[model samples]
Target: MSELNVVSISAAKLPAGPFIARHLIDGDWRQSADGASFERVSPSHGSVVTLAARGGLRDVDAALFAARQAFDKGRWSRTSGKERATYLLKIADLIDRERDRIALMETLESGKPISQAKAEIEGAADLWRYAASLARTMHGESHNSLGEDILGLVLKEPAGVVAIITPWNFPFLIVSQKLPFALAAGCTAVVKPSEMTPATTVILGELLVEAGIPAGVVNIVLGYGDPVGAAMTADKRVEMVTFTGSTAVGKAIVKAASGTLKKVSLELGGKNPQVIFPDADMTSAVDAVVFGVYFNAGECCNSSSRIIVHEDIAEEFVARTVDLSRKVPFGDPLDPSTQVGAIITPEHQAKIHTHVRNAANSGASVRLGGGPLDVPGLNGQFYQPTVVCDVRSDMPIARDEVFGPVLSVLTFRTLEEAVDLVNGTDYGLSAGVWSENVHTCLEFARRARAGTVWTNTWMDGFAELPFGGMRESGQGRELGRYGLEEFLEAKTVTMRIGRTRTPWVA
Candidate 1:
């Protein structure tokens, strides 16, 4: 690890500039090899905050080269897991030290509310710590089978160079969920943070260097998704691709890797279901459903796009969820008092707007909000908290990932109907089953098609919990022991100890 100094800068102390380069690589800040750049527009004020380097295929190659070299020749993968763990710990310490800047930058770039960004940053630092702990735990198994002398031993080896592609939604927080685990598995990585939200990812690279990670072990390439993203996806050198984005793009990455047969892990777009049974706590169900959709302005893939309530409690749940959602304000991301902020970019805002507009045209009732609002202090890309009830599973708004503050409410009577409605969507990313009844929870949890099932809570859990999906929500998993395994490959070693009679069956 390099001895770069990151001890002095605080979240509150990040220096403002004609922002140099947002891409971090080769242990320093740098521009795209092509010398092109893009302006980062603040969705809050509709003004340019900075012009960051516009990277291309050249940058992708450079980043991949650095990561590949680090993995193959720099001894990063050869370092003892215990020894490498110290570097992860040091990086965690640095992340904690610079928590404020990290969080603030995330908000400033991603246009999420300040409080949420702060929480995400703090969570990121904790994520690093958690992943560090898991480093020692990314262990393979030794079992006594096929006779003790067979000596069945499985070794989990790092999957060489990793390409981590993150989205604009959660920025560093999402990357945080992937990176520490990748590092824990001893894989060198080339990170492709979204072109729109690349600031903190670059800053994070600085902290990693200061924490003593060797140069090239972690590299960042910033640019458009096509050339840069396609480069990483198609590059035969990248052994594994850990991506978090739209299901459309995730599928592309998976398909692209077919040539190299590269390993792929994805947390793709979701139309998650939140099923509320008749026996559920009505108040808790309403609150969970409301928060699930509005938190992060419904940008979350796991947001409760489909709210399935027993017909018995449907009316009351809808009323309470609407009341609570009204309390959420859409405003400036910088305001600590703000609960919701602008969508990530104008394009995304337009996408959400189109969904709402089309939903109304298709006969869905706009229960609360389904349009853009002009705030006194903020305007640009801010979208109002929206609720759409009387929705059919076939409606585009009900099935597609709008990725904004929009909720689709549907009613179900029997448990069978609830299960069918929840599983109706093509996506199976995550689902929530709300019931005080253990049998209901257990049965729903067992049968839910999504990757995760939450009881009485939404987006509440530990890093040790595994997160991923069953079908088109993308392949593989993230977090927990499963997350560590994505960056690892298990090898079986067998030695002859007692007999050398391979020709005869014993």
Candidate 2:
């Protein structure tokens, strides 16, 4: 990884002109109704990135009204699935064309490595293409049973205007997970991206317009959760709400949407566990664990922050993990070689340090990093990759979601104990098992309560696979056919050809 300590001033240049960050409503860019705006600072150096319009109730109302009108009156909702697919394909092409620009914007805003940011951009494009394929192939069911006397048809129809709120960690990718499928299902939407990383999402608005999406089919509103996001949840015009963020906020959304009973899909926080058995390949397990926790600085919802190792291999695994964790390069996000970049914000960095301090006080050994790095020429939020050992499952550090580059290690002697440790947390988002024994790996995969389990690997995902959580981690799934179903409401139609009246009806 590149060891460059400072953001490349030359490479990190922003788009020219007085960029007026505004809300995209009804195919036009407009300032927030309240005339409020916020400065987006680069996480790598705490410098001003751009001024983004701070949306509120008025902006939310306008976006939602446009989405509702587009769904209820525009041709987008009535267009054939093939026609929708064509637009989505064009959008995918546009994303690929603008990959570098979007990736740079994402890196500057979120402080993730440029390499990872580019991968996310490519992944987002693939998702749009995948969703496009699903759009054309989406089909309803027809039942011709009942001796030809009755015809039953099951149809999948759009759920109307949807509200999508995405987090900052994987800004474009997370939104791609929900938005493309919603569009493929013939639904109009209003997207509220995280305030920290709203630039890329805003650019997406321009891309949609270029791709020929209808005037009001897709809208972008920038702001925080309150007043803007809350307005979207409470608005009766929005039929469905899909969010990717914290469990606390997800709960609040669920409560707010209860009044209208909107279809809600949430991908929330996780305290995921990675299990390493004695028989597992030490080299592979160590590398996978490192990538699992430290990738994106562990801001990912499915980050395997907890490492549960077999007692026999605990010492070696933790040692190797610590050594590898220490080697993770921390520097400029724009540097192509940097493996670890700055934290999203100073507050988040402080929270990570606090978690490490508490863990140390609670008797967990700090095996690797426990504080922030002071790289020259870089005055931003950078936290060292941390590894905590000798942690009990009951410890707060082991149970809570740190959302940083902090890994907590626990040891178990038996398979049953390992399974219990993995499933002990309230989160059931994702988990990983490393073992050479097929039965052992399969057993752990079966017993683990997570929605997605990795055997002999970690943090692997595909556009075609369904991704989400069970229990408190959140409801519903994203990607694949299941994702399309999330934005569709099923309708059943039955026709009686025999002209016979049912007794109950009479």
Candidate 3:
């Protein structure tokens, strides 16, 4: 194993050794049972950042056992809603208090710009606080119209142990989306964060402990997806499994979880579209399109990688978009001014390049960048923001989720054609429509098959609104009151107030 190289962020108030990361199991930190470990390399410089313990099947078993024990023993499950809310609030408070440290860690591990990292950290804190408020407000419905002699009562109960498996793109943000809601719903969880970026999630485990979460209420397992993640899905004790990653892996998780028939929720990949009508504001559309596809280096699941523009304005719009794409600053993730950062891994970077090359080979015009980038003092994986024009809707680049800073431009002649182009892919996670006419916006919003449709904007999300997708983008929703309901089961209870026996019972 290589020695861990420490990176100091003097202005961000980080700890001495920001590289060392560990797993949190049953409210304590420990090494894997087999003593296996992996090197977590920094994406900014391709250097060994830390040595994270590589958990396997045994660790997954321990985590599942812990979560099952906590749920069945009613340690946290029996707590009052207000008590749970209080703990969640404390966790939110701790997140805010240590925002700087956590944000620095996230930037180092994920290679997202420091500014974006800070925003994500604060957003996660807000999500926890929002979930805490929901904990107190969660209530069951009462049906009073049954009859005077009969009564019906509906109750909402937690769904036993939940397995939360998050991706690497947004470590803290994505985990916060599910973990707090599960805790608020009175469900114990075993979290398996992506091995590539596990530091912030592990740090979150520490805060959960400080906030007085009962032992085994929330366990963090660190390792690859094969044994650790697969074990979690196959375990019968885990009643629910929620995952956020590629659609391919999501399908495998669903199949494995079928053995025990676990309730599963997936937030999968996307090849989302941004439709720019000719009547739209060109400046605003171009700016929003750039930010939509390039934010977080286009690693977001809902990134608008496909831009369907009206043929009338395609030429000008493509030119402006290409110009802006070339100007997007790509450098150190720690730099606040850097708009784009290094790719998560070399393999992923290679995949991005291959996609771009194939697009070119398929006769799509490379309007801007079409290859990797090299920055002084940085030997990490980095790809330039690319904009491809004259792309056919049937091309692989236009249909697949590149998960990189590459945008494919396609032209449409009419509203029906635009909607068809947007819905042509297997994904329906998110879509954006830019039009000044309210009728056009409303029409497109209604016709688009996506779960979330934005008008004149892109990638706008709120804690109070439900977010999810249709078709291959995945099932179930995240955030808002709906997110809390995902971890709960509804039960109906009927009582006889008068004569109990039915006529047929005699």
- Tens digits of per-residue lDDT, candidate 1, 1-506, equal 01111111113332355344466776667888878998887776666665789888878887888888888995689888787788888887887888777777677677777788888888887888888888876678887777756778899999999999999888988899999989999999999889888888888888887887888899998888888888998899999999999888988888898899999898898999888888888887887887888788888888887788788878888888877777765677776777777778877788899999998899899988777766664545777777898888789988888888888988888888888888887889899988888999999898889888988888886788988887879889888888888899999987667765467656
Q: Report clash pairs, candidate 2.
A: 2-337
Report the C-alpha lDDT of model 3 over 28-147, residue by residue, as the tens digit.
898999999988888876667667889988888888888999999999888989999999999999999999888887888888888899999999999999999999999898887887
TM for every model, in the order presented, reads: 0.93, 0.96, 0.96
Which run of 10 residues does model 2 get worst, by summed lDDT? 1-10
* RMSD per model, one decimal: 6.3, 2.2, 4.0
Clashes of each: 5, 1, 0
Model 1: lDDT of residue 21: 47
TM-score (C-alpha, index-matched) for candidate 3: 0.96
Models sorted by TM-score, best on top: 2, 3, 1
Error of 3 at 442 (Å): 1.0
Which has the higher lDDT value, candidate number 1 or candidate number 2?
A: 2
Ranked by lDDT from best down, the candidates are: 2, 3, 1
Stretches of candidate 2 off by over 4 Å are: 1-19, 498-506
- Which stretch of 10 consecutive residues in model 1 shows the poorest summed lDDT? 1-10
